[model samples]
Target chain A: MSAQISFRNLTLGYERHPAVHHLSGEVKQGALLAICGANGAGKSTLLKGIGGALKPLGGSIDRHGLDPREIAYLPQGAEIDRSFPIHVYDMVSMGLWRRAGLFGGIGRADRTKIEHAIAAVGLEGFETRPIGTLSGGQMQRTLFARLLLQDARVILLDEPFTALDAKTVSDLVDLVRRWHGEKRTVIAVLHDFDLVRATFPETLLLARTPVAWGPTAEALGPENLLKARRLGESWRDDALPCSDAA
Target chain B: MSLFDTFFAPFAEFEFMRRALAGVFALSLGAGPVGAFLMLRRMSLTGDAMAHAILPGAAIGFLFAGLNLYAMTAGGLAAGLLVAVGAGVVARATGMKEDASLAAFYLISLALGVLIVSLRGSNVDLLHVLFGTVLGIDDATLMLIAGITTVTLLTLAVVWRPLVLECVDPTFLASVSRSGGVSHIAFLSLVVLNLVGGFHALGTLLSVGLMMLPAATARFFVRDLTALVTTSTLIAFGSGVAGLLVSYHLGTPSGPSIILVAGLAYAGAVILGPIGGLAGRFVPRRHLEA
Candidate 1:
């Protein structure tokens, strides 16, 4: 398969302290890739770099043919402010931002897509409810509906299933599978190993640097997992910078 | 006195009261929506800070033009924009929180403004700048207030979608389009412009009260953006009229009376409103169950 995204000696960090260092890999077209690591292992940071939310500290990220607007990124739930007075339908309609834009009217066809997306997420009757009034599961479903409407060729999810109940997880995992079936490139930062092993065909294990990459079973082997944990534990905040020439 | 004599008579009989009514009505039309966005964005205190930031420019205007409406308005707008942009820069460059930077800048503005006003102008001029001369508004000032209201409403409508997107999910907005930063700057400009308009009618200190109190009160009673803006405007207008009547009867200061009435409205909404009020705690909320 052709590469959808290629990272060459990429480094991403804050204040020049790399969270993801010297990462070189390619996410193939129509692949479901899971990024797994311990806390502070740069999973989310890597996703952010790919989503164009943050600039790389060093190296380059090449998107083969996809434009930046064709990528949909779902940030961690904690990053969103739910208390803002917005209806679930209005929030979901924001997925059409690329096509409709800020001032463009949502035509009848777009409205139908929005309604269908909402129903697909089992949130049909909750369309007009304020986002603040929804439960955690319901809110996640609402966001999933939005993602459905986004219909991006590349979807990046940052800890999408964290704090969700089992049923919600199963439902959202189904959606992720549907994305896979549609031949979209999907990259997700995930913590739960069982879920990742079961759902994602490709796995990248990282601990500030790539420990293993390739098929899920080999990349997440016991030896590689131990190496990742050791690397993560030995990391020092004030360590000297690694030589770029090396 | 009958209801007509108490409420309607003062506005009908006195030209000053009539002008004050027109001035506040115009102020509410713009300030209401602006303030609703402020509350939604959790920038209520930023609104307060920007209100103080306009002081030095209006003070400078007073020094040059001796209470000239056009001069004060222009000066206030300049000063407000300066502080807004300056605070944003400081926050970005230094990684300081925007609120901390805004507070620092506004404090300096307030001090400089007071010093400039007290340096040359009389106490009465300071009182007019600080408390406003709502009862003393002339045709020129009234027209300026109305003109600002028109501009504010139009600009708000134009930037409405992006601004709402910015407030709800800013990262999402940034991902989809380049209008996120533009929308933010535009929203801040609207806040400053409305504050400038409000300063002419209610003075710097109480102007934010006219904006924030009604907006906050409206939030307690409504769960949608349209309803919030509409309710806030109605609250502000009602407070303006009631405050004028109370001032007419009780011989209180007009601007303070108007703000006091708005404060009272907020308190009443907190107690009696259906959404999240004290009364709402006792009564089971049905709408939130979905």
Candidate 2:
């Protein structure tokens, strides 16, 4: 399945203030792309524009000849209410809602898909458990289960790892690499510089305005890295800079 | 008496008893399901608003239409829905908190209802509107209640899944845009209808109390959506029948009696439910697994 998405000079905003201005980019069919950005660089806004959750203030976003629903979007898991008394299985099953069609009951096939997705995410025994009971890592995996159930060729994740442990991060990175092996396009809004350099071949550096977009080796060099750090600190006014990117 | 005789007695009653029973069934049909949604949405206060807002509408309808139950009910429903939507819109536009807006709306509606009743010059009618009379129930009123309940229940059943989905994940659901604001509005409209239906049986205050108490009670015992709805309906039906019987046997007001029974169920659920905060005598082990 060929999955290609293009954002052509897209300007996104809420009300009159623009979040991402004059953005233009293209995701190669079945290519793994990482979006590296400073805080308030409108990475989430750009993703929302591309995902059809928010309409672009200007220009257009085209998903090659497929519907936007064919793309799986895993929003930052922090946005979800963890205290909600919903079972992990039920939460994952919602990803099939688009394909299952409105008013369509969950059948044998849907159940099989849900089970496979859960198992793939390594949540084998947590089907009956409430999502509120899960750890931060487990919650991320549950969201991954939802992404898996969508069965889309294109995956866009917004900060899938913020407070996860080291092992969970590695497991998630491995899952993304597996998706890459299967020729699925993975675009992630990530903060870890080392993870991007090691795992992602292509990187798009954003700092409100487009900073750079190309191979990680070229785009994430010391100068571009310095620029990102400066922009992030400029936004926060007190963000510390440490040489943590190995 | 056998179960058959007890159940069939309502059908075998004269005009007054027949009207009262019909009114109970009508009120339960809409009230039960609507209460379940309100409980899930954590907006049981909106149900309270609907019931309280109906007061002025009923008073005005009585003044203009001269005790015509249908006209008065129509007036109440229209006014209730209007105030409900108006409060919501005002809350959004002004950036005021919903709680503040609801409080303002509730007070205004209550005051307006009382003023209208006072202007109509009948303390007896006002008292009846406050605490309804089963003996005063008539056939036309019964038919109106039945028709309204059937429509609201059917509409609710049709939109049940999406409504539940919206309540569970409103952000994701709204992001997709498949679930629109229309469903929320429709659900609120259903709440208004249920409140209006119950208004005839239990009056305004007692009607809302009965509707909310049963569903809130049902939540502690049930985890699934279907079970919650079923439990709420059963609670409403049982209390309704029991209240009507007690009212007939003893000379107490049916409205308050039914609400009292419903309140008892709520208390029971709180005391004996799986998640109850009782002194841990029958408490289950931590059942939620990761």
DockQ metric for all predictions = 0.68, 0.26
Tell me the spans in candidate 1 whose CA falls farther than 4 Å from its real position. A233-237, B114-124, B282-290
How far out, in Å, is residue A19 in model 2?
2.8
Task: Report chain B TM per candidate.
Answer: 0.92, 0.87
Error of 1 at B5 (Å): 1.9
Model 1, span B255-281: residue lDDT tens: 999999999999999999877789878
Give the TM-score of each candidate.
Answer: 0.95, 0.85
Tell me the TM-score for chain B of model 2: 0.87
lDDT of 2 by residue, A82-173 (tens): 64457888889988867664477899988999999899878999998877778999999988888787778888899988899998888888
Model 2 stretches with alpha carbons more than 4 Å out:
A1-3, A58-60, A63-70, A82-85, A233-246, B1-22, B87-124, B281-290
Q: What lDDT tens digits, residue by residue, belong to model 2 across residues B13-76?
A: 6567667776886687677888888877888887877777877887778778777787778878
- Alpha carbon lDDT of residue B278, candidate 2? 65
Q: What is the lDDT of residue A208 in candidate 2?
A: 65
